[model samples]
Target: MYGAETWRTTTTTIKKVQIFINSCLRKILNIHWPDTISNSLLWERTNQLPAEEGIRKRRWKWIGYTFRKSSNCIARQALTWNPEGKR
Candidate 1:
């Protein structure tokens, strides 16, 4: 059995560790994407280019979550549209 003093020290150490871990997790989840210096001028440059080239340049990459949700939505729609098992 731990003495009273030892029990108090151990509890304090555990609380400190928990606080440090919670702070780290908050920092990791709140990460922001940095903007480039030319980001502000992108609109002007795109406007001067041809329509097809401008559209290509304006395309943004999708994250994994976006793709997963899109696929799930498509599957649900397909199932709803196809009542029979033909699909």
Candidate 2:
């Protein structure tokens, strides 16, 4: 009787479980296509163009948590956080 009850529960839940697992696997294996525009000479010309006033004035915030410490140490850590200079 116990085995029969467990079998019934598992059969009822199997479809829902399979759907959830497939959805998760789909996202995990998702692919991103490369930008064709960025591959062209137009992309190079755009990059070489001077920054507009608004673009130049825009300030990027440093992301990541700050602990209670000396300002100098925090500043140094922020600088070293992304040596590749990614925003």
Candidate 3:
């Protein structure tokens, strides 16, 4: 999930990332083979947000940080810029 906040995520993409996260967490918790746990419980134990929610939060965090920058900043301008013509 490195640089995931910058990704243009789709449902498939988010699902894949979520699956990976869950598997990793399960391994870290030693919840292997015959053992099982619900995703909600896993998240609770790990104190983790769902992949989509986490990514959205990171994206918005970046946006807010950029917005607080000086007006001349390129990232802030990219977010706030309006085109005068249709693409």
Candidate 4:
């Protein structure tokens, strides 16, 4: 998630990230093979946020940061830019 702030996320991407995180958490918790844990429980135990929420937070935080930058910033302009185009 290092550059997640610039990612164009979709359902599949988010789900893949979540699955990877869940597997890592399970390994870290030594819950393997016969052991099982619900996703909600795992999140609760680790105080973790889902991929979607985490990425969304990161994106929003980045957006806010960009907004706080000088008006001439390219990132800030990109956020407020509404191109005159058609679908």
Candidate 5:
């Protein structure tokens, strides 16, 4: 539950949120869910890419290249924001 207020109840909610986010991203990118082996290989490849290449390069090379710039910005903001409103 990772420090959630109610461990047992929150776990299910967390899983559902994760699944929903994953599905949304997949649909937005028009990509299939990766198999276990492919997923591992993808992480390995991502690590090999240069950090200086920036988000656009990585997003295009790995994630769906078709994502609009503004959508990516909004997604990044949503992911990085804390629920408590603290930086």
Candidate 6:
């Protein structure tokens, strides 16, 4: 799915990884993971916050275990690697 000059597949892959990561994070964080099968915006927004912040803030103990896997990737893509880009 890697088409020329398009990050659609990359973005989609990142999103899916994000969803699965969020699910596992919720379970590990002692939060009740939900299984509702509706498309209500209210439920959607409600379910998004904790996981969003948790990821953003790196709020997990097991995160330390994954730091090794993420560190190199993050460093490679980080703004410092592209000085012209905003930090």
Model 4, runs deviating above 4 Å: 85-87
Q: How well is each residue in 1-87 modelled by candidate 2, as lDDT tens digits?
A: 112212323444645644444444434445224432332233244343212211222312122323344556855476457556567
Query: Model 1, range 46-79, lDDT digits (tens) per residue?
Result: 3433233323333322223234565458643553
**lDDT tens per residue, model 3, 1-87:** 677768999999999999999999999999997999999999999999999999999999888888899999998898899889888
What is every candidate's alpha-carbon RMSD to the true fold? 21.8, 22.1, 1.3, 1.5, 14.2, 11.4
* Alpha-carbon TM-score of each model against the true structure: 0.25, 0.25, 0.89, 0.90, 0.29, 0.29
Q: What is the C-alpha lDDT of each candidate?
A: 0.39, 0.37, 0.92, 0.93, 0.44, 0.45
Off by over 4 Å in 3: none
Expressed as tens digits, the lDDT of each residue in 1-87 for candidate 5 is 133321333456655654554454445545674632343344354453222223335445533422334555765455456687568
Native-structure RMSD, model 6: 11.4
Least lDDT summed over 10 consecutive residues: which range in candidate 4?
78-87
The candidate maximizing lDDT is 4
Q: Which portions of model 6 miss their true places by more than 4 Å?
A: 1-9, 33-87
Model 1's lDDT to the true fold? 0.39
Lowest-sum lDDT 10-residue window in model 5: 1-10
Global fold similarity of model 4 (TM-score): 0.90
4 in model 6: Cα distance from truth in Å?
20
* Count of backbone collisions in candidate 2: 0
The candidate that achieves the highest TM-score relative to the unseen native structure: 4
Q: Per-residue lDDT of 1-87 in model 6, one digit per residue for the tens? A: 122112323556656755775665555555563743332333364465433344434434334434445546763245235456577
